[model samples]
Target: MIKIHLSRLLGERRLTQADLARKTGIRPSTIGDYYHELAERINLDHLDLICEVLNCTVSDVLEYIPSHKRKK
Candidate 1:
């Protein structure tokens, strides 16, 4: 399963969806969707903006966790 860890990251930074939206020039609704894992896809440009605003790398924002069946 592809999971979004945005909520965790935001919690760690003590930032709200509104804060990120204002910083990234992204809509609050869009940020909310991403926070809730409702976004089907994200643009690379948007990702870059998010990373810059959050002062984090792509890896910090996202991680690939192997499925339980595929885990060693």
Candidate 2:
């Protein structure tokens, strides 16, 4: 599963979805979807904007764990 750690990063920065949206100029609804890990897909441009705003690398927000590697 590709786990998004956006919620954790936001909490660490004390930033809200609205704050992220405003900073990245991404739609609030889109940010909300990502914030909640409800987004099925993401655009690279949007991801770049988010990383720029958060001052983080892509790996800081996303993690990929193969199914077999996942703990049962």
Give per-model CA RMSD: 2.3, 1.0
Q: Number of the top candidate by TM-score?
A: 2
The TM-scores of all predictions, comma-separated, are 0.83, 0.94
Q: Model 1, range 10-29, lDDT digits (tens) per residue?
A: 99999999999999999899
Which pairs in model 2 have colliding backbones?
A: none
Q: Model 2 segments beyond 4 Å from truth? A: none
Error of 2 at 18 (Å): 0.3
- Give lDDT per model, in order: 0.85, 0.93
Candidate 1 TM-score to native: 0.83
Tens-digit lDDT track for model 2 on 11-71? 9999998999999999999988888899999889999999999999999989999999897
Worst 10 residues of 2 by lDDT: 63-72
The worst-scoring run of ten residues by lDDT in candidate 1 lies at 63-72
